[model samples]
Target: MASKVIKIAVPVVIIVLAVVASSALISMRKPPEKKEEQRQSVLVNAETIQTEDLVYKIRSQGTVKPRLETNLSSEVNGRIVEVADNFIEGGFFNEGDLLVRVEQSDYLTNVKAAQASLANAQAALEEEKARGRVAEEEWRSFTDGTAPELGLRRPQLASALATVRSAEAELERANRDLARTEIRAPYAGLVKSRNANLGQFITRGSSVGTIYGTDVAEIRLPLTDNDAGFIQLPDFANDSVKPDVTLTATVSGEVVQWPAKLVRTEGVLDERSRVIYAVAQVQDPYQRNSPDKTPLRFGRFVQAEILGDATTNVIVVPRYLLLAQQQVLVVDKDSQLQFRPVVLERSDERHAYVRSGFLDGDRLAVSAIANPLAGTVVRVSGDTDEQVADDAASEEATALTSQVKE
Candidate 1:
């Protein structure tokens, strides 16, 4: 009995001592120190707004084409007796240069025959005049009141004169036909194709070749309606200055640029594309006058950038920085984000031109912020470390002063 009681008492004492020690420790322990929650702020990159005058540049593309191209044809019927050395395809010729000559013997014979006919007609006219004079003298010796036209042979003399004029006209026609036997270039240009060769028989109005004028090259550039407003098109009624354009193309495995002028618009919108076409002209595209420049060949694809009208005092920003709804994020003087509704004057693929809604010295956020709200705190990455510290100290002081007033 005594041993049992002692064991039970000892176990009870151990349990009691453990519970008392746990309770004492809990009572002596301090509660966790309360911590004020820190408000979250975003870091973003920004730039200062500074408005300036901007000149717009509009971009377009087109294929180069000759200003003038023609199909050369023969004016007389004959065998091609001679072909000029520069009558083949890709051959260059100057204005009035003979390209091909037909058989001249037949034309020459015709000319001689017509000349002989003219001479015979003149001799007959002279003989008729002499006869008329003899008739008039015979009439005067008889009665000579006024000689009848028939007696004077006036009708015969008139017929002879008409014959002489007809012969003269025929001779002139024969000479012109003889000259047409030789086909000559009408302008300084290059031959695109040649059909007639030596000994080849050809008829009048036969297309013997095709040529392209090298004096000027033209490109038709298409512009959208939005882009058309920014550029100053040529005005036919007014003395408007032609806009300058720079054309770029790849030739001989290298990229090249040529200068051109925006000469005129097509005067109507393209039916299919719903865009306006502007024609640009490049002088001496074959480099005949400007040897140092790369020749802008016909049928080459090129891109053009036209210098457009200028605008004053506009804020230009990268296109990516613009947010939804034509808005942009700008930090206020209190370092809080403010959503600004901007008036976009114009925008390109890479940039946006703002006409209003931003003042000078406004800090525009260039970096993105997800799910931004107006008046949210933000830190500008453009600020120096010292400036950030100064800003933070100033904010803390202001907060303390406000708290004291409250």
Candidate 2:
């Protein structure tokens, strides 16, 4: 009992003495001033929002195709005797250039035969006319003022003239067949393929090969019904000029762009894809009309951007600045963060076009933040509008220079 009491008393006494010692130390020092804890500000980059004339572009992709594709066939039957210098696959030919020549021996014989027949008909007609004149003279000597139709030989003369006309028609037909022996190209184009060869016997209307004109290259870009409304397309009815489009594609690890014009739309909407196809045409795709030698070759897949109506009073924000659920982080005038719901018009690869939700001079937070609250205080890395633009420009220039160097 005594030991238990003594142990408890000793601990109690030590605690009391320690408390008194702490109170004395606290009293000896100057009175400490109480202050609230300071908040650790998050550093972020802010961009000043501005409303400008924004052109809402519609993006689409498609493959390039030739404007005109035709299958060349033979119009006359004969043995192929000659071929053009550029008659092979991937060859080029000018208008009226002879592509293939068939043997003309049989056609020439027909023409000669028809000519001989025509000459015989002409000689026979002359003899018949003389006979009719002699008969008319005999009738005049034997009868009085007029003679009977049989005596004048008028029916025979008419029949002879008809025979001459028939012979002439036959000659013209023979001549046409002879001319078709030499097949000529109707237009300047590139041969996609060729099946005919020298000394190959081909029948009339046989398939030769395929070719396509190089005057223009067309790409069919499919757009959704919502996307089509933003672009102006050419009307097939009234023949209105279409909107301009730009196409970009990667070739040999480099991106190349080509200018094209929206020509026409496919008459009906696609049943499966539910898309409206708009056609874009690139003039002189072989660079025949311009100094730029890059050709927008056929069958190249590319992405197209069609120009649309001008959207006034719209803010352009960087795509990374967009937050969850189409929200944007805007810094208020008090330097506090705000998660604002924006009326997102459209979002492309790089920009989020905001129709409403933002005003001029509102600072938009562009830097990354982790689980940021609405009223969280943040430190601005750069305050001025010009400074932000300068920073962005510097970053872009550095990227371009690095890419060029690489």
Candidate 3:
């Protein structure tokens, strides 16, 4: 019984001593030293915003087309006796160049017949005049108060004059028909298609070929309602300056640009699309007048940039920089991020035009930030030189080590 009590008392005394030791240790220890927390700043790219007189450009796309395209047709019925060497598709011709020739043998015969008939009518008219003079003299020799109409032979003379006039008209018609046998180009252009060929008989008003004028090329650029508001179209009522346009296309794997003028607009908007088409004209599109320039060929797809009216003191920024709710991220002088709500006058695929809500010389944050909050610390582009140098040095060391191993 003594041994049992002693063992239990010894264990209880050990537990009590352990507890007192822990209590003393806790009381004697010093509290941890407090240190101010340091916040890390994000690195971003920024630009100094400046207001300027901005000349905006409206972008649209279209296909190049000829200003004048026509279907050449035959004016007289005949078999094609000859076709010009340059009368096929893609052949170029000048004004008055004969493109096709009909068989002229029949037309020549008709012209000769008409000429002979005219000569005969004229000879008959002279004979009738002489007879009338003789009749008038004989009537005067007989008796004279007033000569009778039959005695004067006036009706016969009138009939002869009418026959001569009729013959003259017939001769003119024959000459015109003979001239129509040779088909000539009405303007300087290139052949788009050819229908009638040599030895082919064509009737009057039958299509001979299709031609396109090379003097001017036109592109119909479609514009939305917003785009139209920025562009100033040519005023037909008053003499106003036409807006300038630049057309770009990729030809033969090379990008090319051509200067054009916004000449006119389609009077009505398209019902289905609710868009208006503006015609831009490129002079000497085939390089006929300007041989040094590249030709803007027909049917080539092109993008057009039209110069719009200039606006004063406008700030333009990249479209991507604009955030939700018409806001933009800007960096303040204290290197803090600020979400500024901007008054966006207009925006396109690539750029946004800001009318107000930003002061000149403000630093605009160009680099993207995820879940950005106001008053977040940031380091601007140039302010991170030391960090970039450290990264570059580390990369160089790694490269040297790899080279040594190799």
lDDT of 1 by residue, 156-249 (tens): 9999999999999999999999999988888999999999988999998999999999999999999998899998889788537799999998
TM-score of 3: 0.83
Q: Which ten residues in a row have the lowest lDDT in candidate 2?
A: 286-295
Estimate, for each residue in 1-406, the C-alpha lDDT of model 2 and write its tens digit.
Answer: 9999999999999999999999999889986899999876888898788878877788999999998999999889989999988988888888889998999999999999999989988988998899999998988887687887877788888888998999999999999999999888888888999989999999999988898898888998888876877777779665676788999998888898999999899878999999988889998887766755577888899999899877887788888777789999888888899888999877767888888886454688988888889998788887555667999999999999999999
Q: What is the clash tally of candidate 2?
A: 0
Superior by lDDT: candidate 2 or candidate 3 = 3
lDDT of 2 at 139: 81
State each candidate's clash count: 0, 0, 0
What candidate 1 gets wrong by more than 4 Å, as runs, is 1-40, 253-255, 359-361, 384-406
Report how far residue 169 has shifted in candidate 2, in Å: 2.6
Candidate 3, residues 1-406, lDDT tens digits: the string is 9999999999999999999999999999999999999876898999889877888899999999998899988999999999999999899899899999999998899999999999999999999999999998988898867898888888998999999999999999999999999999989999999999889999999999999999899999998889889988876784366899999998888999999999889878999999999999998889987788788889999999999977888888999998899999999888888888999888999999998997544599988688999999899878688779999999999999999999
Candidates' RMSD to native: 6.1, 9.8, 7.1
